[model samples]
Target: MAQNLDDNYKIAYDNKAGFGKSPALVLIDFADAYFDPGCVLYAGVDDALASALRIREVAHDKGIPVILTEVTYQPGGRNGGRFFEKAKPLSCFVKGQKTAGFAEGLVPRDDEIIVSKQYPSAFFGTSLASTLTAMGIDNVVLTGLTTSGCVRASCVDSMSHGFITTVVRDACGDRHPAPHEANLFDMNAKYADVVSEAEIIAFFRSLKGEAHG
Candidate 1:
């Protein structure tokens, strides 16, 4: 389903040109307070953490900035009780665990930026847009858990913010495959370039070669 669709897109994009080199990689994850037990958004926790680690490695090697955004839990904030109640039950399952408290991959590097967000869209009520602007980041590679929720929200807003958003299909998963597959399709049709890990890696390699050539 989702993988199949993503594979199709990847095959097409692999034949295209000008994906550009040294594009910034932004990995958004649900590793924060709002996802804690009793607060809601606990499902897909494990997948998020694992995906974060894998993306972190790739981004680090490529010298790409990896911005990790988490949903904060404040009484009346965006991700407070009101929002959770609405979004939580929609999830396939809840598996609350304190995996990545601060950042997705833990112990953030001095150069990396960690954003604390209260809403699904990292661009909302955060300096993410400005940060990306300052860094001259014209493209964003998004990955994380719960493809139907935060990931979708961020991808939409990322597109709105004028960054060419791309969701790494394999690097993102959901508690259930149905919602994930459906949402990824909708997103690809409307906003963002939905691609696979192998495709993205190959694009990065091509970029590096061109930069040094």
Candidate 2:
């Protein structure tokens, strides 16, 4: 899978470039605890799950901190309406599961940070902002599902928070391709550096080499 290898390379490069430098890698996952099955967002559930896992692997290899943001199932919460209507079946499956309903391929190492959130924006009502600031992070590279939703929300706020945000375009996807493309264009124009995986990887590799030399 040359494509997979290239994707991994870009992720690793981003990690290296941001490593011990100005930017920090913030990996967000739309784990099972975060979504309802019947929700329209769940249409590409498998792809979302796969992408999270792939990025997690890349981040771990580079020693970048990965934050797994878990969303609590609140019936009346921001996504509650969607949960009850479109995502009800998915929600039921997750609720019935015995273990913590994380997406597949989510095995963060001991050093990674895991955050449990309740909203679309990862920094909302969370310590993400402070954490990033404390770590001297000025740029944020984001990857995750439903590009039109959580990914977009986080990108917008990351920029507002004064972080040069980059959304790894190939690393993210949506249930439908149209919305995914539209939102990415909008975010790139107004909020983030929506670059391809290869470009990000090149940038990261250069940064990492600079640090060591």
- Cα lDDT of model 1 by residue, 83-108, tens digit: 66766532322223353354334566
> Residue-wise lDDT of candidate 2 within 107-183, one digit each (tens)?
66677677766556788878998998877677788877668877898888888998888888876767788898888
How many backbone collisions does model 2 have?
7
Residue 174's lDDT in candidate 2: 75
Give RMSD to native, each candidate: 5.8, 8.5
Clashing pairs in 2: 13-204, 37-90, 37-91, 38-86, 38-87, 39-86, 39-87
Score every model by TM-score: 0.73, 0.71
For every model shown, the clashing-pair count is 0, 7
What's the CA RMSD of model 2 in angstroms? Answer: 8.5
The candidate scoring highest on TM-score is 1
